[model samples]
Target: MDTNDKHYRNPEAVLDLYERPPLATWPLLSLQHLFSMFGATVLVPLLVGLDPSIALFSSGIGTILHILITKGRIPAYMSSSFSFIVPSVALMKTAGYAGVAQGTIAVGLVYLVVATIVGIAGSGWIDRALPPIVVGPIVIVIGLSVASSAADNAMMNGKHYDLTYFGVAIFTLLVTVLFNMYLKGFWSNIAILLGIVCGYVLSVALGIVDFSKVISTPWLKLPAFEFPYISYTPKKIYWDAILSFAPIAFVTMAEHLGHIMVLDELTHRNFFKNPGLHRTLAGDGTASIFAGLVGGPPITSYGENIGVMAVNKIFSVYVIIGAAVFAALFGFVGKLSALIQTIPGPVIGGISFILFGVIASSGLRILVDNKVDFNRKRNLMIASVILVIGIGNAYLQIGSFQFTGIGVATVMGILLNLILPREALSEE
Candidate 1:
C-alpha cells in the first residue's frame, strides 16, 4: 500500500486527504467507527449536567474541526473521557452547569499551553519525567479508582434492590471478554458494542429499561448551543479550570505515545520517524483544544479504537475521517441523542465496569512491558506509595491549592523515579 493515495480527486483540489485516502471509502468505516464510540461520545455531557444532544453534536463538530485544522493527517477520533467526570460533576453541583462549561472552555486554553510548550520545549522534557514509572501507575489509578462506581451503578436497581443488575453486568462482561478472546473479524472489533446490545436486550426482558424519556424527547428538537464566554471575574472559575484540566494532559500524552507505538506495529511503518512526534503532538493538542473550546471533554487518542484498527487491519486514515464526519452529522440529530439516552444505565454501567478495569490493566501492562522490578525494596516502596496515595486519595496541601489522587501519585512517582537510588528502580 503506497502511503500517499488520493481520495476524491477534485478539480479545485480541496481536502488535502492526508496520505491521500479515497473519497468513496469513508462511509462504512466512518459509520461503524461512529457507532463504536457513540455510547461514550455523549457521556461527558450527560455526566456534567449538560444536554447530551449538544455534547454529541459538539463532539462530532469538534472532531471534524480538529481534523480540518490538522489537514486530516492523523487517524484518531476524539470522545468523552471519564477522567473529567468527577470534577465536572462536582463543578455542576457547586456551581451551575454553565459555570462548569465556562471552566471547560478555559480547559481548552490549557491545551494551548501544552501545545506551546511542546512547540518550544518539545515532548522530550515531558517524556523524561513521565516515563512508564510515573505514567503507568497514574493510568492504573484512573481506571481502578472508578471500579467501584461502575460496579455499584451496574448492580443498582430501583425495583427490589437485589443483585439482578449485578448478574446482568457480569453476563455482559463475560460476553465482551469471550468475544475479544475468541471471536475474529468484525465480531472481535465490536466486542464492547455487542456486549452492550446483549445486556440491553436482557435488561429489557427483565423490565429494567424505561423508554419514557425517549418518547417525551422531540424528534426535531434543536440542540442547545452555547459558546465559551471569557470572563475575568473570580466566580467565573478561570483558575479552577486550569487546576482540574491541566494535569490531564499528562495522562493523555502517555496514551498518545502508546497509540503511536500501536500504529507503528499495525502498518509496519515508523509513524514516529515519518509524521514524527512533532506532527502527532500537534494533531492531538489541536483535537484537545477544539474539544475544550466547544464545552466537550478533552480528546485523547483512544487505545480501544487503535486496537480495533490493529485487529481489522484497516490502515487507511479515511476510515477515521469518515468516523468524524458521521459523528458530526449525528450530533445535530435529536433522535439519535434520544436513542442513545434510551441505553439503560445498567447497560452502560455494566460496560464501564469492564472498560475501567481494562484501563488499569493497560497501566499495569506498561509496567510489565518495561520490566519494572517488584522484588527490590526500593522499587516496592515507590510502587506501594503510589498505589496507596492514589487509591487512598492522599493529598499534599500547599496553601489553597491541593494535589490529591492521581495528581499526588503522579508527582510522587516522578520524584521517586528521579531522586531515588538506582536500586529503587523496579526489575519487573
Candidate 2:
C-alpha cells in the first residue's frame, strides 16, 4: 500500500504534518484540541489526590520533550495515565507523599530500562510479538473501552439520568456531525470545536453550565511543585512503593505500543521503524521522570488527542505543540484553568461520541487494509478475545494497581499469538 493510504478510509488531513491553520483561527483550533485532552489529564491527578496544576505543567513539558525526542515527526500528546491511580492512592497512605514520589520515579525507571533494551536489541521483536491480528482489536478497545463513561456523561447527572442533560449531549453531537458533513473549506476542519461552542451555549441557557467556581479562582498562582528530596528520608529506600508501581509499567508500555500503532495506521507512516520505538519510549520515560520529580502523575501518550486528530483530519505537530503550550500556560492561571473545568460534562460527552467512534473505525480500517482474514480461526480467535476482554472491561488487579482491560487484552493477545501453534495454509 502507498504511504498513508489507510488515511483515505477516513478524512485526509487538511493540515498534515507541520502545516498550521490560518493565523486568525489558530488559537481556536488549538483550544479545540486542548479541550479534547484536558478532562482526563486533570481528572487523573484529582483522583489520585494530587494538585491538577502540576499535572497540566508536567504534561505540557513532557509532550514538548516527546516531540523534541521524536524530532517533531509524530503528532502526539503526553498526559497523566489512569493506570497509576490505584497504586498512587494506596502508596500515598502507607509511604506518604514522598514515597509516592519515589514510586512514580520507579515507574519512570522501568520505562527507561525497557527503552534501553529496545535501543540495544532494536524494535524488530515488537512486530514479531504483536502482529496486526493482535493489534487491531487493541486499537478498537482503546476507543471503545471508555465508551461507558461517554454514555454516562451524555445522559446521567451525578449518577442519575437527566433528560435535560441527555438533550444537550444529543444536540451537541448532532450539531457536530452536521457541521462536519455540511461545512465547506476550513470551517469543516473544526467541526468538533464548533459543536462544542453550540453545546456550551445551550447548556448555559438551560442553567447547567456553572460559573461560580470560576469566579472564586485566583487570576494567577504558581503550581504546587514537589521534590522527592524535600520529603524523603536520607538514604532510605521505599521498596513497597516501588513494587506496587514498577510492575504496572509493563501494562502502560503495552498501551504505549497500542497508541503508537493506532497512529501508524492513522498517519500511514511506520513509526515503529522511523523515529523508532526506542526514541518514543525514551521520550515517554524521561517525561514520566520529570512528572514524578515534580509530584505529578506519570505521563502517557494520550488517545483522546489521537481521536481529535482522526476527527479533525489535521495531524499537524504544530497543533499538538500549540495545545501543550496552552496547557502549560493554564497551569499558571488559576482562573482560566478553573474556568476550563467548568465546561459541562455533556459537551465533553457530545464531542467524545464522534472522536471515539472515529478511533474505533480507524482500528477496523487497519484490519481491512491489512486484509486480516477472519476465515482463519486463529486470526478470528485472537481478535475476538481482545475485543470482548477490552470492551467488556475484564481487568486484572495486581495488588493496588488494576491492569485495565485494554492493557490486559493487549498482553493476553500477544501471549496468545506467541504461544498458540499455527497451522499451515494447506490445512485450511
- Each candidate: what lDDT? 0.62, 0.85
Provide backbone clash counts, one per model.
13, 0
Lowest summed lDDT over 10 consecutive residues: which window, candidate 2? 2-11
Q: Give lDDT for model 1.
A: 0.62
lDDT of 2 by residue, 89-185 (tens): 8877776677777777888899889888988899888888888888888899989998988888898999899999989999999999999999987
- Residue runs of model 2 more than 4 Å from their true location after superposition: 1-11, 230-235, 421-427
lDDT of 1 by residue, 170-206 (tens): 8877887787679876566556667777987998898
TM-score of each: 0.73, 0.94
- Candidate 2 local Cα displacement, residue 400, angstroms: 2.4
Extract clashing residue pairs from model 2: none
TM-score for predicted model 2 compared with the true structure: 0.94
